[model samples]
Target: MSSTFETVAGIMSETADIPRETITPESHAIEDLGIDSLAFLDIAFAVDKAFGIKLPLEQWTQDVNEGKVPAEEYFVVKNLVSRIDALVAAKGA
Candidate 1:
């Protein structure tokens, strides 16, 4: 797995109490990992803290409302990693 994915997995594993080995790029956090809305928020917060970049929570809602990402892909590990990678880059600039 990529380092970003590894970081994300670690965060999710701790935040959601999931086994790290089960987290995959393709894992559907809500459906597969039993992550409910509150857990998702916790995971998001953890992600924000781990990377030292505030995730654009409002923008995520906007993206969902604007159809930027299909509902299914929104919380996928790889997709979330991509979003974090973008923010991580921006923070360094």
Candidate 2:
């Protein structure tokens, strides 16, 4: 899991142009990462490709865009972490 997080952070740093040190489990996707909508989409695609798990960005955008994320806005890194957590939990490994 730690390795996964590191990989995720690397991806965000490289692709999203966010600083690697800016990422942590506690970092808010929007507030801390500063990712806009298009960046969010790019992050989502990158995460899916890197982790080999398909995150449903369209549905996620609909929910998060409508202010349903409970954070009042979108946060790409946090969403990526959530998706990773869900997929990891589902596998029961």
Leading candidate by lDDT: 1
Ten-residue region with minimum lDDT total, candidate 2:
70-79
Give the alpha carbon lDDT tens digit for every residue of 1-93 in model 1. 789999889988998899999999999887888888788888888888889989776677677789986756567778888888989999999
Candidate 2's error at 82, in angstroms? Answer: 3.9
Q: Residue 56 of candidate 1: its Cα lDDT? A: 77
Tens digits of per-residue lDDT for model 2, 1-93: 476778778877887798788788677767777877787777778877877676666776678668777543335455567668677667666
lDDT of 1: 0.84
TM-score of 1: 0.84
Model 2's number of clashes is 2
CA error at residue 87 for candidate 2, angstroms? 2.2
- How badly does each model clash, as a count of residue pairs? 0, 2
